[model samples]
Target: MTATASPTHDAGARAALIAELKRSAPHEAAMRIGLEPPARAAEVLAEMNPAMVQDILEAIDAEARSRIAMAAPRELAAQWSRNAAYAEGTLGRLMDPPFATFRPGSTVGEAIENLKSLVRTAFVTYGYVTDPEGRLLGLVTMRDLLFNDHGTKLSEVMLKDPFALTPDLPVSDAMRLTLNRHFPVYPVKDEAGVLVGLVRGSTMFEEEAFEIAAQPGAMVGIEKEERIATPLFGSFKFRHPWLLINLITAFAAGGVVALFQGTVDKFVILATFLPVLAGQSGNTGCQALAVTVRGITLGDIPPGGASRLMAKEFLLGLLNGAVTGVLTGVAMFVLASSQDSPSAVMLGVVVCLAMMGSCAISGISGAIVPLTLKRLGADPATASSIVVTTATDVASMGLLLGLAAVLIR
Candidate 1:
């Protein structure tokens, strides 16, 4: 008969996995623990951060997720299933089963007696009081339990109408609501205002941080669940399609150049400056793009703020482009004068005007693209850079060559 591992050995292995999970991001933790048997993986996930548990579960596949859930404790498995009932990026997905609850009529001594056993299993923060119907009444801190008379009922000591979060509240909105509260835990209620679960402040903050951190990658078409420690094939699978999309968009810019083939054939100097114009406008657009994405992520942008943002970026771009344009104009004049092109002075004017116009339009596009995506119920950061870059390229190149074709010769 094959011998099973000793209890001590299994405990040590599980302790090590917990340590590893603590050190890795949720996605990385999923990758690391994915090789474990379902039973082992479920045990490790159970001991993880509540918010991280949801993310790790999401990062794994449906078969694996189901297997891990099956192996998990009944309470945790139920919480996972309940969490799945809510939409992504909502507080419901990151909640934990409330522990240490008591009826309002319970005495301090009775609550203390119950906590003795509760503390042995879970890290209870506060004792929640609820109605017989399961609606939240209030909560009592450990301090209240310590200072109050043993005969004191929870209703006499608990803080009334304690701040709570709604289950369906967006994580971004949750962050805003809890910014001032900072309590270790907040009660979660449903649309009917019945208490259902508790979310830890740390877990909520970590989820928000992960969402923010994933955005820069999202702008380039990388999935939020991908991590540096992800399997090579997994990373390739997540990334390859976006790159193909980028290649297709690049051809649009290439076609614009093809349209200007005659202008380039006549004045080769314009070719040298094409990249310069595109690069400058692209940088301007990226500045606007970064700000817009951050605003959306933090819920900083007010409703109908897009038009004001676009106008602000456009003006900022016009002023910045003018300052850069003077220097670019001088460079063009010198390069053209050296080449003895008859349109040297005129070429300088064209460069200056093209730079200013290209940057202004690029800025508007950058701000508008993300705002449009957000309005369409898509991620504001999803491949936004690709869209902004393509717009900048076509606009910058078109403005420069188009102006030359019209005004120069």
Candidate 2:
């Protein structure tokens, strides 16, 4: 079917259009409302008055309510349930409760009679068959119901072993299961196997898109719906802690600085090049760390394949080091030419070597930290950024200062 016209120009125009359209045909209006591009959807939903949402919800039947629910702000559903956490964890929290169902033994005639009393298209389908224990048996399509003899049993023709999930499972998990298996309604059950609800695979997909927009740094894979925000946040949040820890580690490098303090005091020129070496090392290490983190999160590095990944990161570090070292060394040599000291050449060499060593260490740490966190039941995302950033900081100082003490002094 052809799609409906959406408000492409202004928020007020879309809202006005939706309001007028709902008055005449609310279901059509509901579908049209969702069809607007997502940017408009969030903006409209965020700022649009709540009274209008209530009006639209009141005008529609259950099926339409479910559709509207898919697009409605998550906070709206959370309020309906009276618990913000309700929408936080699982697809079951987002599902429309008390959906229509019938026993498997029920005759097609009986099912039709029940369906006839209900509004057409209000329910998902007529073949909504249930097992003896009230578990979903299979969908009985409307076509099948209309053609079959009234007395035919639903169990006789019902598709067995339909797609399903449990209530307590996370929405991320549900989305992954549905996408991988490619089913429509994933029946959700309780611990006792009692069917609580069905998660529409289509709706699940839509919710994920909504989530990706709302949550900062959230990323869902192309192949599955496993939420990867932990790593992003982990990398960002833990970075400070890692920096603090690296501060403690930096003292070791600082001790090296202390050892060379007399030499630096005698030849103050060494102090000028110190920051340059440290800065170059920091830059190289950060570059290597970023690559390692991105690769691990994208699953380009297989789980348990840390060694292989480490080798790759180390190689990248070496390449980055060689190119950056030459440029930085040459730049330092030219910049310090007026110093008239052979120590200037030695300082440049120290920086170049230190940068290469620091980069290699950062790359190896970048790969190892996330893998170690993941293995220990801690989220790798949370820990990777912190560990890598701090490691880079400490390694940067360590390499620069150690080289200064060994060579420049």
Candidate 3:
């Protein structure tokens, strides 16, 4: 059971909520609970109710609706995010606008009264304390409001220059930081240091939960959230280019296979076992690649860590290669070839040698490509899959073909 199981148990209530929101504006209700409009749309959409989808869209602002449209579900809140012209992962995309802000010089009493009056309109997780020019000065939680002396300046009780996220940092990083810190909410700021609005933890978690659901086999055994708020079109853009790169690299392997065409045509016996060697080698390569890429992405691979990573992968590859190679050699010898035939001996040696070589190359290439991309300021996650798989595919094919050429010819 993955963490991404559909929110099926509460399906009925969620459906009713979606229906209610569709008839009304879900955005306003979501704001009270500290959810972005797009996130709200995703939650409602999980019910798979089209009528509710329509109603939600109708209730949201036109701009929000437009952004939601970009997501393909086109609920009203989604459109609002699009229309705001905020780039994906920006504070503008993730925050509720028109949030409350207070002057630093204001009395605690004045600030408290202001919060009380505007509580219905603005989110109260992190009250914005600003200078006259609207530059951020500090933040005040609701607890600060109750405990503070009334005569004190708003600046006194408010957190001075509270921790804030830039509009442009990746949401994944922000979410990780937020989870570790356990802040109820954090402010988002522009380069000029003006407070934009707050990003609530609930919103970040829901968005992350959805994002994790999009990857192949990324479920962590939770329910209620399946997909996350990754930029769908942007992800397509990132993924497509890598796939194209893989396509180009694939030709190298194809060329190697072409080299052994004569050998394959002469001894059809080699052809039958070729797939076994290639498939097993490919699987082993992929295992190493996956582990290395994961370690690198998670920051578990240390600074000046290439040698250590490479050594670990190499040793693992060697072990896997030796085991699989022996099994393959034994199987081929017993099933296909006679003990008296020199060709049987040659074939067995070829499989073992090829397996070892393929595993080593796969491990090395897997660690190298992702680390290189990370150094170049490219996203390691997006590029790692393409690079590692291409290396494994090319290496596996080349090893098998080269072995066939030598042993069969």
Give candidates' CA RMSD values in order: 2.8, 10.5, 9.5
Give per-residue lDDT, candidate 3, residue 386.
55
Which model, 1 or 2, shows the larger TM-score?
1
Q: Can you write out model 1's per-residue Cα lDDT over 310-371, one digit (the tens) per residue?
A: 99999998998898888899999999999898999999999999999989988988899999
Candidate 3: how large is its RMSD? 9.5
State in Å the error of residue 350, model 1. 1.1
Q: What TM-score does each of the candidates earn? A: 0.92, 0.60, 0.68
- Estimate the lDDT of model 1: 0.89
Model 3: per-residue lDDT, tens digit, 1-409?
6565366856765666655443333343333223445555555553433222433455556766555455443333343443245544344555544356788888878877877877774346667888766678888877887888889888778888778887676666676567678887777777888765556666666655544443233211111111233235644643565556667877876776688788767656656666675576566656665676566544477778878888877777777888887877776666547545557766777767777777777767766766676688754444455556666766766776677686665
Which residue runs does candidate 2 get wrong by more than 4 Å? Answer: 1-98, 116-128, 146-149, 166-174, 180-184, 190-194, 206-301, 383-386
Highest TM-score against the true fold, candidate: 1
Top candidate (lDDT): 1
Residue 280 displacement (Å), model 1 = 0.6
What TM-score number comes out for model 1? 0.92
The TM-score measured for candidate 3 stands at 0.68
Candidate 2 accuracy as lDDT:
0.58
